[model samples]
Target chain A: MATLSIENAGKSFGDTDVLKDISLSMDDGEFLVLLGASGCGKSTLLNMIAGLEKVSHGTIRVDGEVVNDVHPKDRDMAMVFQSYALYPNMSVEKNIAFGLEMRGVGRAERKAAVEEVARLLQIEHLLDRKPAQLSGGQRQRVAMGRALVRRPKIFLFDEPLSNLDAQLRVEMRTEIKRLHQTLKATMVYVTHDQIEAMTLADRIAVLKDGRIQQIGTPSEIYNTPANVYVAGFVGSPAMNFFEVTLERDGDQIGVMLPAKLKGVDTPYFLPLPAGGQYHSHIGQPVVLGLRPEMISQATTAAPEDPVITCDVDVVEPTGADTLCVIRLAGRGAKARVSPAFACEPGDSMEFALDMSRACVFDAETGMRLYG
Target chain B: MPQPKGGSSHRTVLDKLSRFLPQLVVAPSFLLILFFVYGFIIWTGYISFTDSRMLPAYEVQGFRQYFRLFAMDRWDVAFDNLLVFGAFYITLSLAIGCLLAVLLDQRIRAEGALRTIYLYPMAISFIVTGTAWKWMLNPSLGIESYIRGLGWESFRFDWIVDKDMAIYVVVIAAVWQASGFVMALFLSALRSVDQEIVKAAYLDGASTTRIYLGIILPSLRPVFLSAFVILAHLSIKSFDLVVALTGGGPGYASTLPANFMYEMTFRRNQIGLGAASAVMMLLTVAAIMVPYLYSELRGKRHA
Candidate 1:
């Protein structure tokens, strides 16, 4: 419905700068998610785009028109808040119909709009009930229904599922995705939950310290993170990092891990050819990045490949896969292995490190070296 | 779940009696709230059904004083004055208090100073606010006089004088005194809101007004109801403010129920009729307060 463009947007509250130099453009009907932890200024950025909070410095445009002076109501956008924010005194029908009534929609049309969205949200039975009487999940639907009745050019969600239980969060996440497909409306959602960003967003903007770390498709961010922080922050159980020195053994290039380094058991000899991203950093200390899923139980001996053996310290069996914690090089390392092997605490296990997909980063700068 | 044999709940009968003995020592003060509070109320209701003299005797002559109460034009005016005052007082106080609380809750600078300014009125006694407002609204001695001296002699601050418009002034004064309390309650409630709710509303593209009126105000319904009941009851039984400010003067233009009942009991010595009016006022308070108390207790129990 509307393309949103934010150019070098920043926010400062008196002396505290919450956001800085944030520039992003969203296509029409795009589902953009601003993902960050609390106080990272994701909500402040969303408010700036909505014409709710003034941009301390920069410009925001909706549908190619500058909205720096536009009123939020006049911006043709509807939002579903995490709290539901339904009027406590008004019934679900009245709450959903308020915006339409405010815009002078006819009585019959308003009723029809309310009924349609109520049905869509599976809340027809709750039409006469006030928000106080409804459960958290039901109140969320009413909030959605309220915004749906407006049919605005954009829909903004600020952690709408954060209030629900885990199962409900998942269900509502799918519901939101489905609703977007059916409506094809432009939407911007803000949440600290990375999984929500992963599942719901067409493009996820990962933020840290009031700056955009990376903005790309979820797959792109997952596979090729902009920096070390983005790599570790986007995944569950986090990616493993260890200081290793790049080395060249005749024809091939690899990084060697010591018998022990500090307290983390990291992989040994992650091979990256000399011509790839960090050829100039030979013998230099670089951090190795290995996703939990990529590290596998190594078997047999391969002289041509790099493999390491470590003492398994603990095993967390999650039915389908076992998270095996091992002490390699005097440090703790995690490997997601098949549960069939059945590892326990204090066992010697070998994990084969795959170099093709392994990432390398400058330890000091925390920027990714290998894509 | 090991049971404690010598726990606080397992006190002996003698220990329980010792604990309750201290309560007995303090029970006499409660008698003031019990007997003089309940006894006079029952005596008044009984005398209202009788043709008793100024000094009531236990002799009933069936609804005779009740008829007198209904026949009095002043009684009707007093009840109507209370309805108007209660409605406007409660509505205006809630609206202004909620607005001020939201403004303060927005992480504004000088929050402590602002809260002090807002809550200053609630800390002052109603008698004090009445005295202050009475002088402030006085035409010849206060704002009107001062303004006329500044060459606005044509401007009339005559709500204090007009019989028709006079009751609204009482509503305004009471709202001013009580809205501070409402603001305090709302500020606390706003602070206690799931901070995530505010973030959610903001991301949802809800304007500040929409977020407050639509999201924040609804979430604060419990506090609103509490403030409403308190201010409503205060408006209904307001005597000090009316008497201190207007003295029910300009020909009883600002007469409320409590003041009228006071006039009947102390000035006119119409004990039977005054008692009836008092009973009616109690019932009126009960009508609003009972459900309010019930809901508050039940919500707590549920929580």
Candidate 2:
């Protein structure tokens, strides 16, 4: 229900900087997720937003009012911790109504609010039970119910689904996304899981080593990552990298493939789709990045899309798609192919590479060079 | 192939010894406890029903010792004093212990040193504690004369010699010697509590006092029960503190049940009455312990 903005927020513990120059603004009713590996300062940033942690230097504003020094209770935000953090001694109903009771809401009103949230979470029968009586997923619902009952200006979730089992985590992830959609509340979530980020967030902010690597919509982050790190981090069977030199052959600029192919007698030239864009980098070594799905079983294609032969080293079937490992530029690279396009290990297979969808990065900087 | 039977027989002997080793090691202590503790309890139970004076008399008498024990004014006073002492000792100790633990839980800079200082009293025996407090409470030698010497003409601070208030002095000494232990129990439980619960309560707008009273303290129900059972047994069995401090002084006003039993058995040579009172004390302790043990074991199984 409120637009939140943080300006140049930084945090340091004694001599070590934990977060630096974190600046982002959220629109009202937006769902933003901070995605990163452990120790990436995502949880720290979320804590700062909740006012549970002091920002060593920065200004945080809510709805155009500076709230840099406001207490967590006065910041008008609710946090669902990873552990659920329900009052172990209180019944589920009491746990949901605790904040309202603290605010001095009437008994009748508190009961109605608790019942409504219990029904919303489909945990009406569990209201009388203590937290220890409930399962992990049930406790998660009660935790969310507690946060939702207050209707705070902002909702902060610090990996609320991290404690649940795989099946229950997916179910709770859907439930959280549905709640965000129904309430249209401003929510900020922190998680190390990219799948949850891709599925639940309107925009994902990828972080590493206490700094934001990139912030954009899920598709933008996946299809056009800002750097090789972002590209490799967001996808499963992570993007493959191959070192090659950008060479121009009669105005057709592209990366050169090694002669390491099983059936090839000499190195091959793989032309770029829009060859002129990379002409300035001719003769410079660059890293080519491509998703596993971009390379598949060979098919009749246009001249821009090239097919090359390589020896398959391994085959893995994942029900929906089959993955084959092949030697490319003297490194094992995974290529996802249709399960029907079967190839066994030690067999030479022809696969087509989609150059337009591929990504190119500077070998030295690991930054995106061309897409 | 010819030696396989010999090897198997040798392994069987070793296996049997391994199975029997634990019981063999435990037999001595088990037998000692059974004879010294439970054996004396049965002997005492039998003696309570006999007309024994100065020593064990084998002639069984029917309910006469209990009748005499119930009728004595000294026994009546000792029973009443046990209640008063137990009430004040358990409640005041618990209140003070909980307060100290909560204050020390605030991440203070000198927590280690302060906790050690608070807990030092429990390390001293009740006799030592009583002797020290006796010197401090003596009207002429300790606080009263020292204060009067500082220019006040009248400073009366002699609870140890006061007959009506002597039991309270016993309670004070016992609480001082035991509250530190209660504080240690509560402090360990307080340390194990999930800290995220406290943070959540803070965000829910709970003040520090309300958070403690409503959320944190209620979760420590087990600790409270444990402290109650421990303190209850200790108060019922209190003897040395009263002996060393007040000596049940100014009459038999401050005598607890244990002291009464000792007086009747050793000093008065009324063995029957002493055994009757000792059996009553055992029953009281059992009454508190049985339910606590039952609930504790049942809770573990459920968990």
Candidate 3:
């Protein structure tokens, strides 16, 4: 196990900067995931950590020692690639034993290590089989086995499960999490899949356009996204945004609900959480961010919860919960309701908006304003 | 509108003819190859056992020509030259070709121009290659005289005229002509190798040399087999090169099997002996090619 620190790392290919001023450090045995969409430099950062790509600027340190100029092999890191990257010419046993042999380990010890890794990966029967002869999952296991046999200081995975089928990906994801728990090794995994990042990482560094958008725990990122991009990029079905004009109402500040319930103009007011940073910007436009779960059927209709009746445009049942699409301030807003709650398109339903859990963002700049 | 019965019949006939047109177009060439290539091979096999001399003779005298061809000292020398030339040519060509391929694969600038420069020799006919090398290897007229003019008076690059070393000169010329083709084949195979595998090896603590030698080169087993098959066939059928370069001179010292066959059949009127030698050359090529083709076809089927 080792600590990995990348300080002010930047990479440029010709005139285009692929990663810019990225600084991140992980403690020993920490599972840090670099998450981003394509062309966001997540994979480039992973390659730099693996020493497969050179750092154009800044320093990479491992175990508190500078490894900016160290070769990948000497850096004592083992990597599992998205393609599995198992040597096609070698058998599973030889594939796992290759690093040891290259490092000049004795033949008998190499064999023993190979056997141990095969057993650990539950691929003992595949020891003599070539990569082409193995299934996708088996090949992934052998790739992991190859890295594990080396027992390196840090383990780097480059979207290793992306090539697998959906079911296999989930199974392998769990297997990798279990492996990390058992080994307690520092792992830096790069992935474009938000689900993989959310489920696997101890701390995720969400990247956008070669810059870190936010670096926090999965819960922290989900509960409080740093910007409009982070909030939109993280969740499935995404958080809804509505143009709202903040208004001061004596002791409380609130936003007007321009609701047309039952074909009648109803005067409605939804109170904003008190002490928001953007409270002084009343009467100005701000994008109100409300997750689907934050707006549901009002079961008890508590005094603090603001209830608004709106015509449901569409109703989609997704097994456990039904999603009701309704118009909120001239924009489509999705509200999650219990499957048991009977509702249909064109039916008016009262959704209790949880103002405490909602977020506000600046309309011009996509940065989050306040809670 | 409904067509008349006669017009409909004509249209059906035309459609049938159009369906059969591709096969009709290809039939003549197919029959020509069957008769001239396979039929001639069978006829040659039959003639090898006959007592034909000076012309085509129908009388059979089984194995007599074969025994005589094997017994001749000139034939023995020709066979020896073939062995030497084939071994040296194939080994040298593969080595030089693989090295050139590796160097060219280094993402160099002006790669297209450099690749064309190396590959240009493969476009030249073996006869042209032979004649060109012949002038260069000629001691008094070529490199020897040029070097002597440069004040090296005792320069002796006369392998073309030397009896023992004449076959090696053929090896050198043939390698120069064919190694580029081999390099092209190997370069394509090298480019197709997965880049991630190389990176994985690098992180596995293997140096660049080790990654290539231990991982990359071993994976190119199919290309190696292909190069060997092509070189072996080319070596066995070599005639124009030996003739243009050495002319089977120095008392048949540099004569390969094909040259010996041509000399025996046309020049020396030993038709049966020539037929026997030709059949032997065919068998040698088949021995190298059959297993390779079988494995290649089988691999394709499996894939």
Candidate 4:
């Protein structure tokens, strides 16, 4: 219903800065996610948008009006909290109708609205019951119902699924995404779970410390992270890093592989990150980032392809795949392979190193190069 | 090798006995409570049916003294006085306590100092505190004269003296002495509240007043119930303060059931009527609590 824009907003508590010079905007009907780990200032930024927190500098505008000085009530927004925050003393129906009642909606209309929301949430039978009487997931539905009954200009959700059990969280996540689709409301969701961000967000803003690391769609952040932190923080089983050096093997440049990199006994040469990207630091230190699935059982595409040889340190079969541990670059690295390779702890395995797809990063700055 | 189960079973039994033997050895204090508290209450009730004087009298007088008690004007005044006291004390204390807790809930500067000042009265014994309050409320010595001495020429804080207004003075003292405990109770509940709930309400466009009244206050139900029970108990059994401050004077204007019972049993020597009145008071208190107890117990069952 409304576009929210924040311009160079910053927050500091006494001496320590919680959020710094943050600027972001969301279009109408977009579900923007503020995804970050704990203490990354994502919640602080959300609070600033909600008017629960004051920004030390800059301005925030909603629907093309400067709302920096507006009160939360006057800002026209609804929020669903992580704890659900259902009124413990009120019935489920009353909880849903509270916002309507506060806005002076007529009794009959409020009743109809509450019933509609209850039916939509599939919690009609729980109308008469108090919040304490309902289960965690049901209470969460009531919390959303409380927000849904009123068509506020903006909807703010602060990790609303965190309190539910795993199964309920998944179910509620789907329900919330569906609700957003149906309502087409402007919503901002904050979460520490990347899966939730990847599944639900139209565009995810990855944050760290007090700054945005990257802002883009899920695929862009996963396929091309701006930094090593972004690349490592966005994926599961996490991308592994191997410290290497840039070397010139004639006109084609590639990073020299360590002895434990399997197939090549002497040296392994992969494409030296495109162009003169790392040419300045030819012999300097650099780290290689590779995902688990990238290195699999060797295929017969090209026999001369860069392959690594290593002795398997351990093998773990997870029904779907067998996770094998081996020494690569003199450090432990895990390779995901098919369950067919019934390798044991002491077995030797021929694992190919897919350096072409592997990301490269500067060791000093932790920024991706040719990622 | 021989089976070790039997030997270990004996050792386990001995171990359990050794562990709990200290608890069994410390059972006398429990019996002491059963005798001194429960046994004495039964003895007091038994004495209520007898026409006892200064010494204990075991002769039956049927219900003669209870009938006389019903006719006494002082007893009537004492009954009315308790209702007045209970109404004013509980309501005033709750209002003051809730307001204080709410104000302190805002991140105030010197919270510890304010809390100590509010709660200091609870630590003082009502017998002594009541005496001090009596001296302070005395028309000539305490506040009335001091303010009048400032050349007001007309000042009357003499509610402690007037028959109609004397009970209000007792109420003032009760609320003053008990509000601190209520404040502490409310403060703890407010502190334990999920802070994100407030933030959620803020984002939901609820005003600060609405957040406090609609969201915060409703969440304080359990604490309110506990404070209500404690304040009610304080109102009904308010003996020492009334006896010390007003002396149940101004023609029994500040008297409560406990004070009335003491007056009949000790001063008037109407032992049988005093016991009956005490039992009646107990029944009345129980009557007030029955619905509450039923609801509380039923709530537990439903849970």
Q: Cα deviation in Å at residue A34, candidate 2?
A: 0.9
Error of 3 at A233 (Å): 1.5
Q: What C-alpha lDDT values do all the predictions have?
A: 0.81, 0.91, 0.91, 0.84
**Model 4: how far residue B72 lies from native, Å:** 1.5
Candidate 4 residues A21-75, lDDT tens each? 8888989999999999999999888888888888788899999898988887678
B172: Cα error in model 2, Å? 2.4
Lowest lDDT 10-mer window, candidate 3 chain B?
B205-214
List model 2 lDDT by residue over B143-224, tens digit each: 8889999999777888888888999999888888788888888899999988889888989998999999999999999999
Cα lDDT tens digits, model 1, A266-301, are 545556633355767888888888787767777633
- Could you tell me the lDDT of residue A192 within candidate 3? 86
Candidate with better DockQ, 2 vs 4: 2
Candidate ranking under TM-score, highest first, comes to 2, 4, 3, 1
Error of 3 at B13 (Å): 5.5
- Poorest stretch of ten by lDDT in candidate 1 chain A: A258-267
What is each candidate's DockQ, to 2 decimals? 0.27, 0.74, 0.76, 0.60
